[model samples]
Target: MQQMITLITNSISKDLPATLEKSLKKEISSLGPVIARAITPIIEKCSASAVADSIQKVVGDRVVNQLDKSVSAKLEATVARQIQMQFHTSVKQTLQDALRASLEAFLVPAFEQSCKTMFEQVDSAFQKGMSEHTVAIQQQVEATHTPLAQTLKDTISSASSITQNLTAELLDGHRKLLALLASGNAKAHSTNVLQPNNVPVTGPPEVEAPLDPMKELGRLISERKFDEAFTMALQRSDVSIVSWLCSQVDLRALCSMVPVPLNQGVLLALLQQLAVDIATDTPRKIQWMTDVAMAINPTDPVIAMHVKPIFEQVYNALLHLRSLPTTSPSDSTSIRLFMHVINSVLLSYK
Candidate 1:
């Protein structure tokens, strides 16, 4: 059977091409119309309603869905932006209120108190400084006032005497002028002169006496004749002449009266005199010490150490006086404290 099947396949394969060719020719001749007929109804149906209507429905639905999505997205974005802006505004307002409350509750009161304290401290310091200056000024004024008062009293007395002298001189001159008018000068100078009272006089003018030396000195000083007045005072034998002159003259002017590079001999003589005075007047020892202190112009201990000339001079004078045979050990001990007090004041300036 396998042999018979192989033989039949060979025979059919040999005849297949011829038969197939003939059949294709016949079918091909009728195939065009048949294909046209089969496809025409489907093309017509698609063109008439199915394809265009379905396409329109699908495109419209897609467009409507896309528009809805776009509108929804825009609305959502606007709402979100409004929400964000509202949230920021609300938070900003809240923070501002909190900051204002915190500052009012905490910082403002503390700052005001701090300012008040600073102002009070400044005011107190100013007052204290002013009070100290006022006290110092008052002390200086008191120290100088006695001499100034004496000078003023002397000036008033001198003025009264001058006025009396001038009155006597004027009356004498009037008598001489009347006598001249009565004798020879009246007609000669009458055209140039006016006589309001037209009263006659007969007495001759009297010569004026020379002024007192003290009065002359006072007048010279008042006239600013400082050098002449100072020389005059120095020449006077009066023990209180210097004190009287000091009442009228400035301390600087008095100091100027001493020759420059001050005469050490004169200074020593003055010191010796002061020492004698202080020794004799035991009650005024402290006052002498104060005068010495004023002359030294004391400074801090460090500065005093560097510039010790004046202090040394004062110390040597004190030492020399204390070493005198008249000074007892008890007196030396008591006087030693004055030096110590001066030294302490110098150190305190540091």
Candidate 2:
């Protein structure tokens, strides 16, 4: 413990002079200002000019022989002041401008180059770091993916097997059900036909009973029930009904049985379907239109009331058909049928 204390004491002793010297320097720096302040007024009173004049007068007789016996003290002082003033304004300004220009020229390019190099280094480092990070992330993803891919494959395979088994079972059941129905299950397939009275009666179900919706519609029309037939036809959306309805009823007879609005509704439905059929089979539709228009006697006032609206509807459909550009054979045939409809209506009016 004594040796350690002695060693510490030696170290402190070695550093004490440096510490004292620093403190002495600090003290001297602090005193320098006070001393300067004390001497400033005295020094100012004995200015350079005063000092020079005093020295000159003191040494004037002595240096008279050495300094050029022709040069006076006053003349020397004036020359010195003039040189100082010129150097202060002119020389110093020129040197300052030259030095600034030189420094700017030297530093600007170096500064720009240094900045560019630094930026390039930073960008390169950033890119390298990003690339390394990306590589690490990709490696990590690859490491994690094998198990995930296997899990997904297993799950998908299991789901596919389950779905296929279920679908096959459903399809087999459906086929068996259909076959049993075709064989005429007594419980499922009832032997009954609904009559006009809507009473279900047991009868031999007719094989290949025509599934024609228009047949019911024709029966409705023949009964002079235009509204029911029209609703059924519109619900069916069957184009064949347009031709069948046209053939079954004389246009005037249909109008005579139904009210004007009901008659117009039926006519419009027929015309709309006729327009569709004309787009597909123009010649047949045109013939159908002509036959229907002929059934109208335009001169009869009662028929005229019904026939005028049918003509107008046909005219509108014709106008729409004509508006379609005749760019295809179908389009051209449709236009011809439209013209035939217009001509047929005009002839009925005549």
In terms of TM-score, the best-performing candidate is 1
Candidate 1 structure, TM-score to reference: 0.31
Ten contiguous residues minimizing lDDT sum, candidate 2? 188-197
Compared with the true structure, what per-residue lDDT tens digits does model 1 show for residues 28-147?
Answer: 778978988988998898787887788778797888899999999999999999988987899778888999999999999999999999999999999999999999999999889989
Q: Among these predicted structures, which one has the highest lDDT? A: 2
Q: How high is the CA lDDT of each candidate model?
A: 0.53, 0.57
Q: Could you tell me which residue pairs clash in candidate 2?
A: none
Query: Which digits, one per residue and each the tens of the lDDT, describe model 2 over residues 1-350?
Result: 99999988987898877898999999999999999999998898779779889988999878877666547676788899998999999999999999989879998888989999999999999999999999999999989998888987886676556545443443333233223322433432211211111222344542332377667766778687765565455434556665666567665455454233243233433444465445445555666555445433466532344344445545555554444443366655655665675677667676
Kindly report which residue stretches of model 2 are placed more than 4 angstroms away from their true locations once superposed: 1-104, 187-350
